[model samples]
Target: MKTDLNIINICLSDTPMQEFIRENRILGRIISAIPEIPFEKVKIGECIRKGREDLLYENKKTGAKHTKITIEEKCVYVSKVLKKVAEEHNSDFLILDGFLHYFNGAYWEKIDESVASDCISMAAEKAGFLPVEAQQENNKKKLLRQFIADYKCPPIQTKDDDLSISVNLRNGTLKYNNGEFTLRDFQKEDMLRYQLSFDYDPDATCPQFDEFLDYVLPEKQAQDVLMEMIGYCFIPTRKLKLERSMMLYGEGANGKGVIYELVKEILGKEHVTGFSMAALSFDANTRAQLSGKLLNYSSELGGKCNPDMIKKLISGEDVEVKTLYKDVWTMQDYTCKFMFNTNSLPKETEANVAFFRRWIILPFDVTIAKEKRDKKLPDKLKKELSGIFNRVISGIKRLLEREDFTESELVNRTLEEYKIRSNTVLFWVKKEGWFAVVPPENTERKSAKVPHVELDFLYEKYVAFCKKKGMHETSNATFNERIRKLFYVQTGSTNNATWVFCDKPKEKDIPVSDDTQSPKSYVERFIDNLNEEK
Candidate 1:
């Protein structure tokens, strides 16, 4: 309900640069969706702050210390400012555009964090709605999604007894008696959300990935990985919990450019942003200019070596210049889904979490490509990709409606179908269920005799771990045994056991088969089939 309300109330807050940021295709697309909310872009005061320090000496012989005023003045020049620009446009949320900074990646040290949080919190408190932190909000979203999925709500409209309208929020598809709804009058936001699913492979080397790689060296594996990386751009509005930024990696000449090209292709010319860190080092004026626009767009900018600049850009809080231009620019704040393709070092430190969460890291590999192509992406591949993209969005929508699964669990379960993990089976079993690690059948594999989660040993061990970490105490609902699908080691018994295994079961864990065989193999088989089809 709160999310729905937020969706309805989406509008721009009083932050400068909001318009320019929103005008970007990605942000614009999100704003265009969710028509219930009004949005407007205010013409902002363009403040250009110049930082220059001149060391003056009164008397060279006297050797006296001189006062140096670090005068970095920000002159706010108004240009046809619009009041509450975001709200006027009927948007469901405000999109702020700003920069943040971190040192060695430890904590959020932004000039605007406190002020922005205070303002938003105060407003939310007055409105009896607290602004949700990303972590907390994720939990809430997960729970709500699960609730909605299982909820058997009556149709909003029912015509004949044989026909009713059921809509899947994931794909924004309406079903009339289980049939696709013919277009009558459609809303733009819903369609965009449905269309703009983010599900590409930064390492794909196929048409989906190779679409961009065609310009670079061509190889099948590289193309496939690239395709996977690029596919993620469109899944967010469908509620896919994707990382906002990406890190494309591989050796040199490995089609890294190809992967990045995929990003440029879908984000459109206007939305794809670049940053140039060297520009700031060039001069004071250059540093000032780089402050407002997207940094990743600069042709000269490369990710691996520009940690400081990237950190500054993402945090939207504080940026420091060490040279003659020791300018402290307080950036505007906003939520942006940042995508970065790099060869190495993608993790953000504690200090950069605010900015870190805004990014979804993607890696690229050129050497893995199987073939080289010089032409544009084939029409057939594009068509396949279009369908796959839609399916991915729909899958995410369904995923969001499930229980508030842990982020790890979400990753494990969602990626299970992708075969992204080679050695593990994502396992969910009740305590009373047969075994924790069920080895495959007829392969000289036997199920380990691990006790259920409620057993004395595991329960005590887990409780101790939770206590040591000061985590919340578990309740009956929290006893489900959820495990990532990873490659397991063969234990003494017929079956191989894995560390970090769970024996608990939740209400949703379904039981199967009269025989003593573990249901895991069946589950794996189903997933394998699905992957084969893909």
Candidate 2:
């Protein structure tokens, strides 16, 4: 009898047969040719006996001996079945760092190994690759391993330039260049493995974020600087050549912490890593966490840090990182930017032009009063993430066009203050009035024979001051160099390296017996005078 293939297609396209037919399209045609058995009675993987004229069906699960299909046929069928699954999911069976990842429309997301294995098993069974009889369990395990080995692709490596200027949003990828933002559909070729938790909406407005910024950074120029700095963080490439790290510094409950929270929210928590300056400097494990992060920040930055490490991080140099239970690897073109929120500057840092040039210090001076604090401000800002993201995009455009961060009066002053505070010798000199500003040549003080002090006497005073303040004093040679850089006083080779043109304090302020006074009392008196002047 002639078989009706159309009727078989309709029958198999319904209920349980639908899933099997979807996975193995060829099985539907072969099964439809058997006219003796009703379509509803046929099950996937059923054995068929081909007699002289007719065909007989027997369920493989009902202890029926096998009839026609061979193991080779099943293997081919399973391969085709899995290939379809991979195509539909848009996956190349890619692996990265020993983890399986699949494309989910917007970006590639990690898939658990167990979940992948289960999926393979189910698809194989639907494609009529199920095990039979007492060896069923063993057969299933063997089939799973075989399929996994067949489909697994080699691990892929990511380049730093791959993430440059492109941000994966929930809806699509946003690419920025010059002063324009172009949104496009996500492409598999982009190889983006991560995405922001929020969608990009250009029309969104963030009044709460604006208010927060205005409150924290009152100056328009300061706000512009902050916006530009944050915008720079979004770009994962250091091609702009702006090798500077940011520090938000103050003592009170200023809005520095709130800014950090907002940035964390905008960038998504997964893309930002929290590593203290010290940890990033000395801890290999912490550096490992920074491999794919866009920003690395520390809220409580204090004490001394390795200036060389800081320079390397901000300069986008290749850094050596070691993960737990893994071999050390070099992270090429490390692009993570640094931002620190500290109550005080580090005790000691390299005092030089290159070191200080690598830092951008923004002072947080406005402290919120207890009665005027907004308890729910952060949550309110959270609702404005989309709007804030747009603002960051705008800032990024401005930064790219200018090719630098905004330089303002407040920024310069804050940086200078931080430099002085970070250098103990400079701070001591500025605080103690140890050297006076040289007056004009025609001034009365200039012609008073320029009261000179021996270099040895000045060194003794500096040592005494350092001892009283519990600060480390620089060596005599270093002291002389720093003093020359800090003050305008002329050093004369005569009289055993005399510091000439140094004006003495008013006669009334001088001690009756300067040689008899202790260094501690002198420091106390100087401090008192400084406070009075303030």
Candidate 3:
């Protein structure tokens, strides 16, 4: 009963020959009965089948026959077959964190456990380990468990350098350095785990995308900013070291939704995650969802926004994330950029300079008429993905050169307006015209006389404004502190009453500054004067 020893040799490669034979007495007995011969010339299955027939017995009374190939024996046989199959394709499989990953030519792709098990079973079946008709599924499952236990390995540790430098496109790998982009074919050494859904076609034209941008953004500067942002989303943002979240804000029927959908399509669904402001602020599980993602976005942003959490996410700080059914782990240097579209801003208890500076609010003011709205605009934009990718590349080039997003007039104006609107005290002060700038008596003087607003008068106005706007007015001490910090104004005691030395609010809009290209609000000019004096 000669048999091929190749399968046994491969399966027991890791185990001692004596140990394997002792563990499986039936297979060992069949192998021991074989005559010494070249391993490749004999078939082990034929020898095992011949030996199996000798172990069969018939029930004399009922005429029923039973074979000695028990369920346990079948599982053991199938597991050995699986081991042979696994050894043959060892380079094709990787176990990371107990998850099986299969190399699919270009990169290692994670495969579901059930899928891997099915594949292993199919391989075993092909190798002549036919499943018994009575307990095929149960037997197969047991075999898969045994195979996994024998195939365990330490997870491969992924590093930041492995994922950050190269952008994986469907066609190739794209790398950028010092304003230059190099595109090359994918290599196994690149170690990329994910890839963009679209091909990298440099000559692709996206006229529909161009038209969509023009229709939505209207201003060329805003369009450029959007393009740059989309490009920024294409790469790992932590490399840029810019910590800013973008908000597309306006009423309904605007183009914010269209832009969001287009960006998602270009980046692929797997690379982007959607989380509401409320979820991100309060849910630790939501933070875990950001792992391995390039962008985190939401269409509806509402409820209270936690400044501390928002800052941590945008600034690439370490955050604690507890994955479902896993131990708590810290996600360090998180690079996912936050982008959201909202009709109303989220409520923040403390909206300060540091918090406001991290946000870029782009106003979507244009509302397309219902009759003129294109129902198939998203479908049309999908056709131009490759061309749109080119536009994104152009933006990436410009962003790398500038080292920042395009500073548009619309963006600045919208941001400043949001800052003021979000702060009740500042909004009240701006709207009520309480603070005004006083001119210097000497034209050559660097500092101007700072006008004072009576504290009692200011507090009264603030309380009334809060009441009218349905806002909760802070205590007198808190109000005073916010005014001093936000306005950068001083306080003075005059005639037993406190006075805020913030200049009176300007009556008319000042002309745009030559250097800034934007008009300075009275509070800004006052802050500038205060800084000059210091």
> Mind giving the per-residue lDDT tens digits that candidate 3 earns over 396-481?
78877788888799998887667667667767776775543332122321222444667778889899989998877878887886
- For model 1, what is the alpha-carbon lDDT of residue 221? 37
Number of the predicted model whose TM-score against the real structure is largest: 3
Q: Local distance difference test, per candidate?
A: 0.34, 0.64, 0.66
Q: What's the distance in Å from true for residue 129, model 2? A: 10
> For residues 145-168, what per-residue lDDT tens digits would candidate 2 score against the true structure?
565566555445455454457778
The window of 10 residues in a row where model 3 has the poorest summed lDDT is 439-448
- Candidate 3, residue 422: the lDDT equals 67
- Between candidates 2 and 3, which one is better according to TM-score? 3
Q: Candidate 1: where is the Cα deviation over 4 Å?
A: 1-244, 252-255, 276-333, 343-371, 378-385, 391-534
What's the CA error at residue 520 for candidate 2, in Å?
Answer: 26
Question: What's the ranking of the predictions by TM-score, best on top?
Answer: 3, 2, 1
